[model samples]
Target: MTSHSFSKFWSTDLTRDSLLSLLDTPTLKSLRLVNRAFAATTSRQLFRDVYITFRSSTFTKPARMAALERIGWNIRSVTFVINHGAEMFLPPLLDPLTGEEVCFVFTPCVRTTTPTSSPTAPASGSTSTAAGERQGVYGTWEMTDLLVKQYPPLFHAAMNVSSFVAALTHMPALRHLKVSCAGQESTHRYRRSVVDYALSSLRIAIEQAPLPRLEALSLTPIHPGGIQYLCPMAGIGSLPNSCRRWTQIRRLEIHMDTFPFDKGQATDHLKLLHSYLQAFRALRDFKFRWVGDGHKGPSPLSLATEPALCELASRSQACPKTRHYLRPLKFPYLQYMVLGNAVLDASQVSDFLTEHRHSLLEFDFEQVSLRSGTWDDALAPWRTLSSAEYDAAWGEKQPAEVEVMEVPFVLGPSPEESPATSSPEQYSKRRKKKKKKRHARTTEVAVNNDLFASTAAMLLEEEPVHRGSLNFRTLREGLSNWARSKGMFWGHGHGHGHGSSHDYLHKAVQSPILV
Candidate 1:
């Protein structure tokens, strides 16, 4: 077909959305070869969110970037991810139940930077092209200078900090910037310390850049097969200088999987948090997630999994008290705050709420505990929830919220790794003892639930009274009256709920804890 005729035919053949949908990376390259119109359309789509990975062998980045700069204004976000690995860094296989490393495989490091040392070669078994490219990039004066200035020992480490800053300075429309340091240490060429240095250098570079349009920032680490050890609070304390320039930033999230849970580290975190809240005056939403549980499992090895940290156990170990108190800080524009797996005391929580109550619309307390001095003190916050106010506020359009707070009232014994005696007779006896203990715990849970229900019925009365005048029947009648008044049915587990002993005991066991 003639060029003009072909252009006209393709343009009329597919709609914009349909045309764009058909253009994956390989397909886009194929389409670009077809005609000028196809090339223009494909180029626009490909350059929308420019991605640059320094170590990938798939394509030459400098060449690709030169192509994108011609249409750089079309780009909205720039993502820079550095991959590094150290010779001694081994991936861990975790225990299913406890999340601890069950075994580890140690292997000799492979030299990836040197082309001749690479495992794969070209179809013709030639090495000149690959070696030339590697040497050209690494041997460049600019690249060597960058490596020496930022990360000296880790030459293969992706030191794109200065490049990122330079890139950010040029891109006027870029609003989102994500820089991640993950799996950066490779087998043969690795520097464990350089990872932090690289990350810190990246932050410093960002500080030097002026990005007024930048709105969202995510600085995270990605570790393959295992959990990442996040940068310390001291390293994060450097952000105020960088973030001060980010006035338009409305959303800020930082994930530190390796934050220590000791009292001293907790103090440091609180200090950092205060500084952040004070710094981001225009921030509308803030989220801080520390201590990532590896493999999303109930990691007994994690300090976050300890009963003392989250109040997970009914009987908790006494923690060394800290006399230090959190000073009040305000976030006038912050609408939402999420502090995942973070433990704060009642006073600290109250202070946070009071400071941000004007603009704070939502908060998440996932794995969060508000440690109170006493049970009554803990319940004091909910004591003033007026039924009249609730009735008025909840309507057809806005529904009242019902939360089922799960409190662990009974904790089973921790599983033993192995029996002390290896004898078959002793092992058999141990197994039997363990089974009996498990059954006993189940029975104990049932008894505890029944006791709690009877206590709630007596104590949680509509008309408050002293212990002498406590009445369960009156409380039941009051609950029934309120249910009828609300035009809601209260189920006594007659038809829908099984009335068998197994089900009854289950209800009696689950009610106090689950409800």
Candidate 2:
């Protein structure tokens, strides 16, 4: 067929399934640019999943805004990197796609630099720069400042430090919000003063406006020290009143670097965790990681589980209306649970798995040591059958009439060697020479014995019983003949063989055979 004719025929003959398959191929991208008809059809397929690469030097804020604006309102998902200023980038991306449910990923730029300082360098004069700092100044953007300056309402409405969250207040279709800060400095900046300021500002802004539709919030703060600051107990007291607006939040993940539970200020931390659970009654999944030094502390969930502190856990049982919080803990709704060096007693882990095992699909335990008896108690219920029963159920088929045999050999000093009393030096030299000869002879005898025993066992186990056919006398004579041919001892009980058969068996068992 002619090229034009083939093209026309293929296009007309393509089914919906075939068209989708064709579009998935790498060649389709080039094919789409061939003609307007191909372009129009392929544009829909290409734009269905919107992916923006922020690392490209060509991709500026305005260009990104224009590209997103041009994609129309049909874009469903977006994956983008925010090297330095996610605050500036996220608002516009979110602003144009308010009607559609979107997923926003913020990945920090990877640092690429070699260390130049020695470990012994003086603290004051150390010239080494942090990995994040080595990425240049423009590579870092304060998330709180970026939000405050750009998207104030979404920031305020979502209880995020960034003002950019304001952009989502009116976005009823907003479903997923993921924010991650990179490195310790960024985390410190976010938690120390930025997060508090942002939240405080957001509270004020939300009081002016509210987000009734936002559902899922995932915040990963990389600063270990920032978690205590972000999830402060005192802050929890104020959040109960101010956070009444986020009634729709169902999934929350607060990833931190350090959760200082031993700082004697954990009462507020406990209260804040409880308050979040209380505020979001619709919540189904909650995860928290203790990033601080893992010293055992008062359970954050203890207070929340308490009837006095958390009125939610107390009043209802089925689909309880009260707050349900899992602090470095697992829950029934948890389809995926990652217990990272959590200080949970064996019973707690057992209880959690028992309640959630039916629904739990993925479980990860990192640096999570189980207490004694925990494993047996947790897994014993799963092992219903004994080893024999289990083998009968699932064991592979075995061939009939398998033979097994046992044989023993003994090693003794050479007949030529004489026992004698001598000087210390003479005795030492003689002992050394005897030790080497003994080792060599023992190894040779052990190897020969194993081969003979294994051959006998196999023959006995596999051969059918012939009337009066199997005889030890004939077997011994044949072995002696074979040993003579192979340059091994063949005489009647040479060396250690002069001892009892039981003694020979002991030597055979004790001798070390090198493979």
Candidate 3:
């Protein structure tokens, strides 16, 4: 194919999807080399999702600012990593006509460096010069302050993330919003106040913002505390009246390093979960990850299956709410349910499935052990029980019971002969007679050894039968014949045979049975 044809085919068929997979660095460089059409396509892919790490200085200050200016306007999702009390500066809105507002925003960070200390100071004469050098150290800080003061609106507006979210309220296309900090654990300790403030402000913004198309909301913690505080904030009592009005959210993911496992903690966690369920009638997907010290494992609170489920049933029965509100509140819309170290017994599992079996697509039970007989039988029993509960609650008839069958094992005769009437001497005589018969057969075979002319013929006669009952002589003859066919002899020093009947029978019986 011609290069032009190849390029066109690649761009149209392959590159469109492939470009989305490119990382930030490669995508940016590719845009410069490509034409307008290619650049536009690649730019959308590059700016579709933006991730900012607060801990990394490279991504935090200058590099991140440049990236935001280049693509932040078109970004559908933004995840922040706030750390070290360093605030992120917002990029100035691009002016299509002038393009003069595009200026870099420089934010200074503290860095400590130590120069080699002189053994002898140059007396008081050099103290002033040293003091001047120290003063120069504060130059960057002053410059940052001056810039903040000069552009109060830009700096202040950016500092209050609520306003930024408010601006995004009219963005009908916006779908996902994620806020996080820098260090996974340490950030929680140092930036807890900042995160709490940001979340509180965002909550207000979300309440007031015109988000008619929002779908997913994720609160991922850069520090451990972010997750720790999120659940409480979403609890029934803790959530603001306005916050509970978000009825359009469908997916929520809360990732934290610690979750309260005690009864008090569990109560708070459940309350938070209940509040979310009550508020977001459209929620379908839920995920929460709890991280804690290895020494201190998960919480030990047991969920009350009967009372809790009974309450839900009562509410559903009494409420005459519309299908739109009811549908979201119903367990049937739950597509994915994941319980990590949560006390979910068999009854709870059955109750949950009973309530929403039709909507449940994926269910995961981690670090939770069920009762021994909980699922020992077919899963149908559990399903039936759940169905029964639903039917009873709705005043319907119960299903018929299922019959299960059990099979018994059969035993054969023992190796010992029955001695109801026979004496010991009679049994000994019977054994001797059998031995004599076997000896007679061996002597007859030796006498007729010369009947066959060829060695192969002799070997064939010596070969033992593989089926039915056989004695020691038969096994010995079989082995002898097999060795001779391979140019070997029974009396040769190369091969030695152990003569243990018990061992031979054990080996034969232990071999695999191929049907």
- In order, what lDDT does every prediction score? 0.48, 0.45, 0.47
Clashes of each: 9, 22, 3
Candidate 2, residue 445: Cα displacement in angstroms equals 99
Candidate 3, which segments miss by more than 4 Å at Cα?
Answer: 1-3, 10-15, 19-24, 53-73, 83-162, 166-172, 181-192, 210-213, 222-245, 263-270, 295-330, 370-382, 385-515
Model 2 accuracy (lDDT, Cα): 0.45
The TM-score of candidate 1 is 0.45
Per-candidate TM-score against the hidden true structure:
0.45, 0.38, 0.46
Task: Compare candidates 1 and 2 on TM-score and give the better one.
Answer: 1
Candidate 3 residue 234 C-alpha distance from true site, Å = 6.6
Give Cα distance to truth, residue 228, candidate 3, Å.
9.3
Tens-digit per-residue lDDT, 1-515, candidate 2 = 89998677657735533665655647667877889877666655665554433222212233544554455343333332222333322334232335442332222121222211211112234344542332231133343334335543323222322222232233333355455544444333323333333334333433333455446666554343333333323342244455555555667766555444433333444555554444554556666665555443233333333323344344467665554554433343445545554554555555555555554555566665543456667555235545554454334336689789887878776544435545667768889998997787677666666656665555566654641366645654556455555453533334554354445444433433200
Error of 1 at 40 (Å): 3.8
For model 3, how does the per-residue alpha-carbon lDDT over 268-330 read when each residue is reduced to its tens digit?
A: 334334444455556688765554554222212223332343244445545646211212235
